[model samples]
Target: MTDATTRGFIGQLAQGDRQALLSEGVEQIFPARSALCAQGEIGTRVMLILRGTAKVGRTLSDGSHTVLGLCGPGDIVGEASAVAGEGSARLAAVIAVDSVTCRVLAASRFRQVLRARPEIYRTLVAVTNDRLRRTADNGVRQAAHPVACRTARMLKELAARYGRPAPQGLLIGLALSQHDLALLVGASRESVVRALSRLRTSGIITTSRRKIIIRDPDGLGRAGEHH
Candidate 1:
């Protein structure tokens, strides 16, 4: 298996395995925005997010977007539906955050690969479980907490999940703007700004450009949780 920063792929195989899949008709697709692939469509491939971010969400009759989840690099964009074989395109659109390069795996070819790599089933299950838990947890916070508290909780969670520990505490990769923070925590942009201002004034958080420096993390947690 080749170690890709985001998605896992089988690579460096013997010449035979490489030739086997090449004959099975796997193609790459570069889809643009507002592209609607309906449910029960004959799905020919699974997509792995190699770059950029996409929203895996459903559409309402009002034509509004209810973001079911977010997919970033290293994420499996579609597999469950592919596994089932017959279902509507449960996910509506995967709009390009920038540009995306998806390594498409045809269903028949994918099944053959899976037979050779039975362990992939376990890996897929584990990944699905993790994503499910994350979505459930995010739902609870968005429903239960106010914006400021939600933002704090999200930052703490993000720090633990994706951020690397700095000597000072934890540095979240992006210096998230108030707007992004609002979207993440399901709060109004103005509210996120107020909360961030409060956090700054309290000296519990600091920022350098797009990175969030969580100063006094415990204190920040206490402040957010208590309020």
Candidate 2:
């Protein structure tokens, strides 16, 4: 799992452990906007991302989709269902945000690896716990904070995790639309647009072609604080 607070699973593994895990899988490439995995389907394999980014989300009963998290290089997807034994339904859908390369492993093989490598299993458990905690925290923040505050906090997080230094400011490497941000923040697209406009007008951030540049990180942090 990839998140602002937690490093991806492959990055956390020892070099030997990492190599061992990758050796079991076959490399596959997915194009941008492709579905890596679908929710509610039986999971047969898990994917370890080697390059690019993916978005995890679940569709609601009312036909709306909620963004769960973002996955980048070194992250693993569909592991939860793979770990849940045979015929386990996937809890979320993962789609390629950009061209993605992954090492794909069958569920049985993954389980076999876990049985042989207790250390790896422990590490996966830790990562899962961290993801769950972050999800819970986001839920609480959504209920307690204003949309603008939450949006700012999310931007700061993206910058901290995936940002690269640019001439203008810290550029978030992920290509995200206003609707994607809205889904991630659990707000209406209109509300997210207003929040982003405010950030732009105040000279805290700038956006062009789905790329966001944080001009004043400290100012963004201040804006994220509860008002």
Candidate 3:
């Protein structure tokens, strides 16, 4: 068995499993903000992200949305619908947060791949469990943590998962708006603004034009510990 990683589906598979999976899909590129899948729509395929990040979320009846998670390189999307059988509807929407490249396999082909490799079934179970675990953790943080702590923890999480070196500091790869950040942390937009301002004032982070740079990741992490 391969080591577990946030890289998602294909990442859990061994070389042989990976190759066999790739053989079933065609690569496609999507620009930032493109919707890869939308809630309530019948899924016809599954996507394996090869590069960049995608946001997974569901739209509410009030026109608001909740961000469930982010998907980056090696993550798979739409698998649940595929596993439910063809013509199954999506439970959420997945949109590219940056320019993305992905391998898309038609539903019929994906089902075939599942049956052909029993090992893949095991891998699928593992990946699905990891995703569920993350969702549970996020819920706990939102319900129990204060907004400042939640915001700080969110920065730490993003930096750990997607940070890239920059002259200024470690740039978080996602270009998240304050509203989007609010959605992720389950805080009000005003509260998120205040939290970010506090972080900036403390010299733990800096933000500009939708980009957030972590100036002191250690400090930011510590902030998350506060009630």
RMSD, every candidate, angstroms: 5.6, 3.0, 3.4
Per-model TM-score versus the true fold: 0.67, 0.89, 0.84
TM-score: the better of candidates 2 and 3 = 2
Could you tell me the lDDT of residue 81 within candidate 1? 65
Q: What's each prediction's clash count? A: 8, 0, 0
Q: Between which residue pairs do clashes occur in model 2?
A: none
Cα lDDT computed for each candidate against the true fold: 0.60, 0.88, 0.85
Instruction: Tell me the tens digit of each residue's lDDT in model 3 across 79-127.
Output: 9999998679999999998788888999788888889998988898888
User: Between 1 and 3, whose lDDT is larger?
Assistant: 3
Report the lDDT tens digits of candidate 2 across residue range 60-141: 9999877899887777899999999999999899999888989999999999999998888988998899889878988998
Evaluate model 2: give its TM-score: 0.89
Model 3 spans with C-alpha error above 4 angstroms: 1-6, 61-64, 166-169
Which scores greater on lDDT, model 2 or model 3? 2
Best by lDDT: 2
- Candidate of highest TM-score: 2
**Global fold similarity of model 3 (TM-score):** 0.84
Cα misplacement distance, residue 33 of candidate 2 (Å): 2.4
- Which digits, one per residue and each the tens of the lDDT, describe model 1 over residues 1-227? 21224232322233454445434443454554433234335665676655444555566789775656445445555576677665424455555443455566766566667678656655667767877797798888888777788777877765654454687767754334555556667778898878877888888787765468788778777755834
